[model samples]
Structure formats: structure tokens, C-alpha cells
Target: MKINMLAAGLLLIGVSLAAVNMYYYLEGTLSIQQVKMDSPLPVKVTEASSDKQWPLYDVKPSVGEKFAELYIPRLEQVFPIYEGTGTEVLRTGVGHYIRSALPGEENHTILSGHRDTVFRGLRHLKEDDELVVTTPEGAFTYKIYRIRIVTADDHSVMAPKPRATLTLTTCYPFYFLGNAPERYIISAKLINKQRVITWNPSR
Candidate 1:
């Protein structure tokens, strides 16, 4: 009887620990939530775009630091983007793959997030859906052209592109109980670009 009781206690402890970890995984970005803009600013403000000289976009962030923000109109969600893909980095928000392009770099930019958290709404994204990505320098509009599920080993989805592209990735089967073997990918191409005035760095 004592052994059975001890086993039950251990099981309860394990479940409690798992719950704690899940909270951190899902709410990890809360600390950075204040940085999210109430709504993404419009890109065509003449004063901000007149000179076309953007210094904010050039602000180089240190490794694992906040680099940008993504605004999804479809999901009505804004998430902070951080540099580096380490566990600690992802805990705050989206992780920018170090090897990918930075905003306005005319190359591919790859971002990753947790399936249970920041990217949970991605499953609703459809082809042709438009989204905005804002940086200290400006705002960019991209239209999704492809949504696919690929094996985790797939690299072509994140491969270099001659033109500017944005890719958001998360574990597939959004509600899967454990680590999922497949990956969900949202691929978008830059359509409209604009330099904007934002209070991000200051706020």
C-alpha cells in the first residue's frame, strides 16, 4: 500500500512539473508583450517616407536580442522577433534564424516560434493572406503564397531566395501532445515596402 501511494505521489509531481514548463513555454513572451504595438502603423506617412532614409532598420541588435516585430492581420496578433534560435531566446518570442536575411536585406528571413504559443494561430493562415512585419526602420507587407507541412529535416523551405522572402515556421499539428515530427511553414514574398515612424525603440 505504501509503495502504491509513493508511485501516485511521484506521478502527481511529474504532472505538476510538466504543467509548469508548459506555462513558461506558452507565456514566455509575456515579458515582451508591451513592445507589441496596438496596431501596426501605416507605411505611407509622407513625413516618415519622404527622405527614404531609415536608421532604425539599420539598428543592429546583439545576438538573442529583440530585432523586430510581426503583425498578423489574420490572427490579429503581434509578436516580438528576437535574434538567435536557442531555447532561452525562443522563450521570449519568435527566434530569427541567424543564417537568414534581416528585414529589407533582399534575401530570405526565417523565423521560428513555439507551436503552443506565439505561432499557435498560424494554422489558420491561408495562401494569399497578407501580413505586416515592422522593424525599427519601417514596415513591410508580405503576401503568403504557400502553406505547407514539411519534415523537420527539410531545408529547402528555408533556403536562400533571390528575392526578399519571409518564412514563419512552427511544429506541425498545432495541438500535438509532444514534439511533432513535421513542421508548418508559411512562405511569403515582399510586395509592399515602406519606411515608417514608430515608437518601438523608445517605447
Candidate 2:
């Protein structure tokens, strides 16, 4: 009888251990699923509003996070705009300067991309070409007014602006084999802005 009792006790302990292991396994699976569901989705532009004032973005995007899409009408291409100018960020698409103003802001907004990648056709862009930056808050349209080639060390292109401005930078000599010695700069001024209304299915 004692042997039988011992066997029963061992069975109970084994069941309890199995239950605890199952509980933890299920919890871990749910946590991973929750994180996947919480990932941010691309913001879609629904409509354009005629509001005179540009919508202000109070919250800034984290580094390496994609917050906007740049549409170059002349190039007929759209590039995702990430928050930082790191190598990885530029490899995927355009990078926004963290210290500069964001789209629709009343200051300078700087964007950069690799010459051979996203900005390969930038050399073909001329004055009056439209560059549209669409963010969750709004869509800003800028007209290229000037194109300049400056030394790689030049920082004057980043000076403060009285009005909203967009500056695009890329390595000069579009087809250069190695690191280029000059910087190609495209200066554009905000000509129009439209507020974006994002639609959420949860709402």
C-alpha cells in the first residue's frame, strides 16, 4: 500500500509540473503575438484639406522609424523617409535629419539618400520640380528653386530658414565608384500643404 501511495504522489507532482510548464509556454506565445499586433502600420493619406495653416506634428519619430514618404513628381518615384541618417536607414530609403524641422514645420527640413540608390535620378530634377513629403499629419509640397554643388564639408546649406524649406542632399558625381568629394544640394520652398486624415479601422 505504501508503494502504491508513493506512485500516486509522484503522478500528482508530474501533473503539476506539466501544468506550470504549459502556463509559461502559453504566456510567452501570447506576448510575442501582442508585440506583432502592436507594430505601427503605414499611415495612409485619405484626403487633402484646404486648411491654410500647416498641421503641426508635436510627436517626433524615433530614430530609424519611417514617418513619411517622399514623392518626386519628376522622378516618378516614392521613397520612404526614415528619421535618422545612419547607414542602415539610408540603405533602405531616404533619411531625415534629426536636428532639422519636420514636414510642414516653419523651418528647414533636410533629407538625404544614397546617390546610387534612391537619389540616382536626382540629377535630372530641375527648378520648379515638385517634391511632396507626405506624413501622418499632412502632405507638404515644395518647389525646387535652386540646385547647387558644394564641398563635402559645407554646412551652410543647413542654415535656419524664415519659412518652411526642404533640402535634399546626395553625394555628387552620381556614378562615382568610391566616396564622392562633393555634395549635391537641392533647395526647395514649401509652396502648398494639405492636412491628412488617417483612417483607423478600430475607430
lDDT for every model?
0.77, 0.79
In each prediction, how many residue pairs overlap at the backbone (N, C-alpha, C within less than 3 A)? 1, 0
Error of 2 at 102 (Å): 0.3
61-105 per-residue lDDT for model 2 (tens digits) = 999988887778766566778899997677667899999999888
Best model per lDDT: 2
TM-score to true structure, per model: 0.82, 0.73
Q: Show the lowest summed lDDT stretch of 10 residues, model 2.
A: 28-37
**Candidate 1: what lDDT?**
0.77
Question: Of the candidates shown, which would achieve the greatest TM-score relative to the real structure?
Answer: 1
